[model samples]
Target: MLQSYNFALSVVLLNVIGPSLSNCSVNMALGMWQKLQIFLAFVQSCSNPFDIVCPHKSHVQFRTQVHCNSTRPQYMCLYDENKKQYTEVCVEEAETQREGYNTILRGGIDGVPCSTNNYQPFSHSSNTGGSCAIVKTSCNDEGQLLYDDGSSTTDRSCRCDYRVGYDYVTVPSNKCFCKPAIEDCSCYMKYCDVNQVLTQDYKCARVYKLTGIFDCPEVSGLGSKDIEKNKKMPSNATKTGIFFVQIDYYQNKDKTYHGILDLILGIAIGMIIASVVLLSTADILNVVRLKYSHNDVIHIVCNHVETVVLCSIELKCHLESTRHCKFIYWTKRINGDISTITSRTPGIHGSTVTYPSLTLDSPLIEDCGEYVCCAVYDYGRVCSPPIRLTVTGDVPSFSVDNELHNTDIGKPVSLFCKIYANPPCSNVVWKKYEDGQYTTIHSDSIDCSQTKYFTFTLNLDTFMESDSGYYFCYATNIVGTSKSKCITLSERKYAPTIEVDVDDNYCFNKINEDVSMPYTVSANPPCTSVVWKKKGDGTSTTIYSEKIASSPSKHITRSFKLVNLKEKQSGEYFCVATNEVGTTKSQSVLLYVAEAEDDDFSSDENRSTVTTLPHRRTRYHSCPSNWETDYYPIKRRSRLLS
Candidate 1:
């Protein structure tokens, strides 16, 4: 009965724990497969298996779990084929557990132990095997699950599976995803309407596929009115179905931001263009103005003494004709008063106007003022600057110092004329009186402020007798003219000519007897000194020197006297005349002084008588019969002769 009870107990234990043990083994195998897949994924992501054992904080809760508890038997059942009986035996529990755990850990299964969680039954008849339980769940809105048979993970884990031309992105918590990629949307067309010109500011050539969000590029160069009218246009993409639409845009090439250098270049170009336009306009205006304007007036002068003077005004007009032109004359006084001159003769022809003579039969002092001439034409009038006129009562009054001037040869001399006039002398002229007429020598206008006197000079470098003449000056003004008295010029005296008168046979007694010799001297100016000189033995001695009386004809005769005739006075005698210019000597006359000659003094008929001649006559003396009467002629001599 006890044997029967033990066998029944063993059968019951097997029946109760068999299915549980199989399920546990299946769960463990599935867990190990899942862990292998996780290890492969981790190696692909981080390239290291150690990271899976120690994951980051974001993945710590999802790490794989490994089972470490052993599943082994402490006893075993043995079978005996010859006796056809089965027996039970004891085994090493610790050694058996250690060998079973090592085998499982090494991924090998040698034998099934009597533990429920370590073993499962195999059926060779069916292809289906035990697997882990699966539950059906839904994915998030943005993702879908990959179908495997008809089951999926019960933990609600899904992959991002999107349609064609679409993609997804997960949220920060990784529990949700988004499908932001869009296709076949025309957001660029909505922003830039059909009427809007496609420029660089509103270009849309590329398509956009955003991940997390949908944004469009900015559009520009649209007017405020256009924008307001197009307010109903869509600015953002629509989020529908499994995708969100996006549009991309580009900036306009023409309307772009400019740097400082570009801005400065633009401004400089604008200024240059404006300046060119202005200069062209100014040139045109100047050409037009020059075509109509008249030329300037030339300066003119007129004399004051004239009774009538033509007022001629010339106008140079560049136009074709000047048919309507007239001239007007005006006069102004020194006191700053102006008056229009109406009395004028009119003769206008083309650009020239010759007004009648301004007649003044009896012009007063008031008429001597400034005069001006003006031309009046159709376009404008041009006037010349005023000119002055002067009037006086009479010519200048002048006087000279002397009527004659005596100067030596090769000397300089000046003639002066002191003028006094009511309005001062305008001109002073020096003239030379020659050949019964006067010839101009020098002329100049005197300045009244400096002096009213005028002087003229004569330079005598090569003195000649012909230079001796009359010189006079004339002073002139507006009213009349006056002349100074004529002046004469005389040169210094020249050397004189001398002539001696003596008898050839006039003998004088060597005693207290008186004798005289007469000499005639002729010079330009009378002789100032006359001397009696004796020449003998190759020498000359002056016997007498005295001032001689002059004659009106510049010729004089003087007697050279000897108080007593002596033997020493028997030499040749001559007379000399001297003045400032030169000296002159007469021819020598031989004289004989002896004792009373026997034959000449005994004769009563040959008595020596001194006969005086007239003022310019030659003296005569008589000779005796026995005395010699050889005549010696009186010689005429000049200073210029040898």
Candidate 2:
């Protein structure tokens, strides 16, 4: 026979072929060793009963109680929620023998009855006392089972029991909301119930459920039972409320496998997109290179770029993405290809670019010409087409060196003129103004270097006051002409050579004596005039006058005579000479004249006269007179007189 109960509240086992069934007493006892082993395993797996159990009444009560005085024994109990209480069965209890009023319920889910057959006679109610009365009512709402009241008068009788079959006299009430009892009333609920096993729907009924995470168990068939002949069992066990709840094993396995596949697929898709983008960008760059040619930027315009700001034009290369490129060099092919690179940021295009714009520094006429620009990506030297830039006006440039000063009087002056030209000047001329005529001292054509720069010298040895104005060294070529700033020439001042001389008697004479002295003054550059002065008083009293000729080749000479000599007039004397260029003076000289000596006379001729004819004759004959003669004395006197 099959049996059924709630999985959480009661567990019914249909022993189809176990050898333990017997036909004697209502208690079916197990061997001591077997009983102890089952009890110990169950106790180890069960949670605390007090927290989980609830007590309630249900028809056909099945309960167990074990008390041992000789040994300390442990027992296992399970909660029966369908029966609304805890159910404990002793493993060592012996099974009952009579089959008078017993019916077994067999099925697998909650709320379904098991098959009832072969015990229909126990279903009749006789109101008589017999063993058949034990099957008086099926477990229903009226015949309720409860725990004993906690009092001395409380009923302790075991009204229901399970094993082979100790029948019950009353039906048990089944309720869902009863709380677990305290103290002796402690109970718990289980998963299965008796009605679920007896109903025919139990065989095919499906249990519906929903969960937080997806999982499903493998389906299996239910136990088969007949409801018509089944009678209620006396014992009531806990119902099997809702069991089989744990982690969602089935869904966890599927999610883990799905996640791994998604990651691999995502990586593959990313790699493919990156490769396509790189290839497309490379092809576009290649197409731009083939479109432009080198001969494009070599063009000529009539006038150079002039005006403060004219229309802005651009010189562009067709290459835009110059990520690997270096400088863009520009050259004027028509104008001898003078080259320069823009020191500014250029405009960028798709695969092309424009240079720093074709603008003027201050808009000059010299810039009106042709130009070219090239792009250098690396050491590889990539070149672009020449760009034709037409500046409107001519570029005027003044060539000059620093200002020159302190030149020698008779030396030549050479100033350098340097100019940078856009179209190459015609010629450079160095000139000076003389006699109101512009005389070109030096001239040269700039066609040699094409840059207007040359050296020129002006012979200024004969430079005079009239030549001391602004002298211009002008540069003029085919492109344009510019003059160096007017360099000023000034005449240098210099003193002339001066010579001075005094007459033979320059000393002062005695008072009232006629003393005469003469002096001369002279100079080169032909002294324009001359004058004399006395050193005692700086008064320039002119004693001589003369006019001189031109400098370096002419000179002048003048003389002055002083006719009066006096003690007071004896002092230093000097002369001054002047020329057209400057003046000069001589150093002073001092003069003094002494008085004449007085004569002394006596009565020497009154004494006597001695005659000597012989001495006289001898004196005529070129002989000396004798010593003994008075003629000798006379001769001596004559000698003294001669």
Candidate closest to the true structure, highest TM-score: 1
TM-score of 2: 0.28
> Residues 1-642, candidate 2, lDDT per residue (tens digit)?
001211211222112111122322102222322342244335323522222121222211222223322242322243344564444322333223233332121221111111231122223221111122222222211112222221221222112211111222322232111212211222222122321111111121111111111121111121111221133343322221122211100112355544554464345335433443343444434434433322223222322333321334444344444254443444344334233334441331112234423433332344445554344431222334444455543444665565544343455554555555445555556677677887776443435344434354444545444455667866554445667777766644455665544333233334334322333433333566665566545454433444544445444443343333345545666667777677877766455533432211122342122223433321111011111211111123233223
On residues 1-642, what C-alpha lDDT tens digit does candidate 1 reach at each position? Answer: 111222232232222222223344434433433343343234335422112222233432232122112342222222233333322223234222321111111122122221211222221111011111122222323223222212121122333321111122323122222212221111112132221212221232111111112132211111111111111112112212222233211122332232432454346435533543343455435545654454544334442332212223332222222354444333344555544443332343332345423444444455667665444443333455555665444556766777777776567665566677654566667788899998887444446634444454444455556778888777776566788787787775679898765556343444435456665788877778877777867888766667756555577665655544565657677878887678987877766665553433434455455544345323223222232222222222221111
How much lDDT does candidate 1 score? 0.42
Query: Alpha-carbon error at 217 in model 1, in Å?
Result: 72
Model 1 residue 301 CA deviation in Å? 17
TM per candidate comes to 0.29, 0.28
